[model samples]
Target chain A: MSTQMLTYLFVGLSFALYVGIAIWSRASSTKDFYVAGGGVHPLVNGMATAADWMSAASFISMAGIISFIGRDGSVYLLGWTGGYVLLALLLAPYLRKFGRFTVPDFIGERYYSQTARIVAVICLIFVSFTYVAGQMRGVGIVFSRFLEVEVSTGVIIGMAVVFMYSVLGGMKGITYTQVAQYCVLIFAYMVPAIFISIMITDNPIPQLGFGSEVNDGSGLSVLQKLDGVLLDLGFSAYTEGSKSTIDVFAITAALMFGTAGLPHVLVRFFTVPKVSDARLSAGYALAFIAILYTTAPAVASFARLNLVDTVHNTAYADAPEWFGNWESTGLIAWQDKNNDGIMQYGAGAALSPIKPSFDGNTGVHGERLLSNQPTESTNEVYIDRDIMVLANPEIAGLPGWVIALVAAGGVAAALSTAAGLLLVISSAISHDLLKKTLLPKITEKQELLYARMAAAVAVCIAGLFGIYPPAFVAQVVAFAFGLAAASLFPALLLGIFSKRANKEGAIAGMLVGLVFTFTYIAYFKFVAPELNNTEHWLWGISPEGIGTIGMLLNFAIAISVSRVTAKPPQSVEELVDNIRIPSGAKAATEH
Target chain B: MNSDEHTKQASDVSQIDNQKNYWKANLKLLAKLLVVWFTVSFGCGIILADWLDQFSVFGFKLGFWFAQQGAIYVFVALIFVYARQMKLLDRQFGVGDENDADQESQS
Candidate 1:
């Protein structure tokens, strides 16, 4: 069958499975709605959480980003996965013992203040929305490219599918669906890796394939050949530090802490029965996620080698239809600088033209990369990072069904994460903000109705954002680490560990961290244009890294202010003791 | 003699709940965690990266591999240690499960 037909078949079959599960496992009570009735096996919850955690960012954009940056990409591999370690160790079990349905509840009770709870809610909304926006956009990109639809239409369709399952079954549906998604996405990711590994290194395992001998009798490993080729092409050695080491280190830290603090991810721990289960679940989740995280570097290195080999020193620099195909999508762009009619890996300036060379002379080349794609012929490349996962099969010339499977997997990753994040936002709004705070008298049935309404509304808002995301925003993803690092990480780490963390301190910390980080991002990314591009951003720490600084300030100010304020009282102290002592944990705690 | 035994039992509960020593225990755990988090990330990736890059693993520089892969492996190991230690510490303070091997189910 044609790739298009196969894509439709795969997407349809996967969607059908989710809807079927949602129908079969519709949540009957608020407990089930929130934690799948707290009956999930630890390993099952771990698999679901892994699926929920790995987004389109990890599945698609990550390796592509790595292929471009080479060595710097390891920061992402480390940063994103490292957070899981922190989550498992520092937060997950304690919070699970706290026995709360939402992150805000723990914050509110831990700090003994309503305002603190509200602030955590705000932070949860901010981080989850920023994350959900990217997933929604991913859905659009996958649909438009493979299913032959408008990006906006794709977004709306994806939103509706998520709304149906999540509204009907809440965590119940989302957990099982994510398990399926984990299977689909992992299979989708690994098949191509195995194919490419076999084709290149004669080894089927990506982890070992990276270190094994080169297929050609070159007497050097594939990595060694890669280094030689990259350096020969004016690129830094493939594994050398090309990024500002400080920026790489700071960004990795921010991402790691942010991952640990993200509400939707930590909330998965509550789905298991016991604190010990929470700890064990985390180990299992990491193991499942490792299947892909460990394989990613190998995929990146191989893709970089394949891409360069295809285009470098060849008569057909862009003969592969892959280049033009992705170029039209506006992700990949090549400028014929010096009119050398070749692409080179060098310093950005040497390879860049100050003006567009697409009108064959005076027109723009990079901005609207798709519109003027060297129409009549010479090889000008413009492939996007998101294309890496999708194009992996094609780049290696795998079976057509394998390419279809990739498209399905990308959607699965995006949809699973979107469902998980959307549930957090909706629950926080309806269960925490509305029912608990605004209308405490609402019946359980009525609250369930509003929860469904909240999920639907969130889906609509997310769909809109996916369509017309703001200027200077490179798709809703660029904000993930920054927002999480700034607002959520400090509050979470402090609330549990520090006895002096009072209400005023927690609120002040969150507000200050959020405003400072947000404003800093706005200035560099969006505002500097109107303000004359000033060299004033406190050591050029872009919005992404600004969070690390903001988080530190949050810690300092929170404790400083707390020292001068009232301590949480004797009863609140008792509550803390109770939470830490698992044997005394109650199924329900009213006070 | 019975009255004397009752007084000793009361002292036992007080010792288990002693706020000062509990805080000290929590502090110890925090210090250990910070060391692990800091060493694996800052040490493996940045401060020692240059010197360590002199060594190579699987033809990849040591620092780069640590920055990318080794630190992550260490991080995974750290969590397992943290979990095991916390469980033990909880047991020492009478804060752990009364039944170690028993599992509970809810209706």
Candidate 2:
């Protein structure tokens, strides 16, 4: 069968499977909608959490980014996984014991103020919306590239599928669907990785393959070969990082805390049956996530080596089939800088505008004519980092079925995460904003109706973002992590660890963290893009890492304010004492 | 009546003391595990990465391996250890899940 037909088959089959699960496990009550009736097994919840955590960014973009950036990419590898430690140890079990339906529930009750709940809801919405937009765009990209459909049409289809499961079955549906997605995505990710590993180093396991010598007669290790080639091309050694140690440290810290604080991920813990289960599930989730995370670096190095070997100094007329395929998609481009037909892949930008602008005409060599002016640098190729994973199978000449599987995997990743985020957003709106605060007198059945309505509307908005992506969609991803780290993480941690953390202190801390982190990112990203370098960054921490400072400020302010303010009420103190123990969690969930 | 009140008060004090001791034990365990967590990730992975790169195992620099792979494996282990230890702690303090279910039924 043709690749397109297979892609359709795989994507169609996977979608049908997800929809089947949704129908089989339809939610009936508010509890089911909110936390899957809090009966999910630890292993099942772990799988779901893995799918929910690994978004399109992880599935599609991360390895590619690491391929281009080299060792500095360790920041993402360590930062993302390490945060699960904080979650499992510091947050998940205690929150499970608290037995709340939503994060805001804990903040609201622990601080003993409705105002704190509203604040948390706002933070939750901002973080979740910023994240969901990226997932939608990811879906559109995969559909447009693989399914041969328009980006808008792809986004609409994605939205419809998400709406079907999430609105109908809520968390219950999302959990089971995510398990299926985890299987599809992991298989998709590993198959190509293993194929490429053997092709490059004769080792079947990518993790070991990357550390082994190249299979070719040269006898150089993969990393050694990569470092030598990159250095020869005027790029830094693949094993060395260009970023300062402090910046790397700060960015890693921010992502770790941010991951733990993310409302969508934290809510998954509440679905499990017991406090111990929550801790165990977090471990399982990380183990599942680690399978991909450890393999990604191997893929990164292997893909980088393959790219340079296949394309560098090759005549344009003789370029590999995959080159022209990706070039037609505007993700890869080559220009004859020296009037030589040979391609040069080097360190700097190939064109002045960075992205190619097709001129609707073919050059003498039949390469697409670009309006972009050639830069003075030696580089003559522009490759979008996002295409590495998508183009990997083709680059290595893998089977067409593997290519089709990748397409399905990418969609599964985007949709699964999108569903999880939408569920949390809807629950936050219906559970926290409406039932808990604004319309406290609403019936349980009415609340369920509102949750579905909120999910439907949220899906539409998310789809719109995918169809008409904002210019800042790519830039604001940092804001999601930063804000989560600076605001919600500190507030949640303080609420659980310190009983004296009154509403006034918690509110003040969140505002300070949010405002400070937001302003820092905006100033660097928009107000003065030219000054967004290490020299201008505060304490040598880039805007991406400033969240670390913001988090510290939150901790300081909350602790000081709490000390100065009156102690929390006796009841609030008792609540803290109760959550500290593992018993009575079942009773706590009853309310 | 006086004797009965005194015995009830004594039992309440002992229960409170047990709760306090359980919390103390939990905190101590957390401190130890977190030290390992910090050492592996922030210590070996970041701060000492360059220094530790002088050593290599199977072509992977020691620090690079920790930064990319070792720290993550350790994180998974830490959580499991924490889960098991906390379970034992719950049992010791008579606060395990089964005990809670039993108490609820009696009430």
Best by TM-score: 2
lDDT tens digits, residue span A1-591, model 2: 999899999999999999999999999999999999998999999999999999999999999999999889999999899999999989999999999899999999999999999999999999999999999999988998889899999999999999999999999999999999999999999999999999998999999998999988898999998999999999999889889999999999999999999999999999998888998999999999999999999999999999999889999999888787777778889889888899999999999799898888888777998999999999999999999999999889999999999999999999999999999999999999999999999999999999999999999999999999999997797569888999999999998888889988999999899899999999999999999998999999999888899999999998899899999999999999999988778889888
DockQ of each: 0.38, 0.66
Q: Itemize residue pairs with steric clashes in candidate 2.
A: none
Give candidate 1 misplaced runs (Cα > 4 Å).
A315-318, A333-379, A472-476, A529-536, A589-591, B1-12, B18-30, B91-93, B98-107
lDDT scores for all predictions? 0.77, 0.93
**lDDT score for residue A207 of model 1:** 77
Where does candidate 2 chain A have its weakest 10-residue lDDT segment? Answer: A320-329
Q: Please name the candidate that would achieve the greatest DockQ relative to the true structure.
A: 2
Measured by lDDT, the strongest candidate is 2
| Per-candidate RMSD, Å | 4.4, 2.1
How would you encode candidate 1's per-residue C-alpha lDDT over A39-109 as one tens digit per residue?
78888999999899999889988988887787778778888888888788678877887887889988877
Error of 2 at A88 (Å): 0.3
Task: Considering the two chains of model 1, state its CAPRI-style docking category.
Answer: acceptable
Assess the local accuracy of residue A202 in candidate 1 as a C-alpha lDDT between 0 and 100.
93
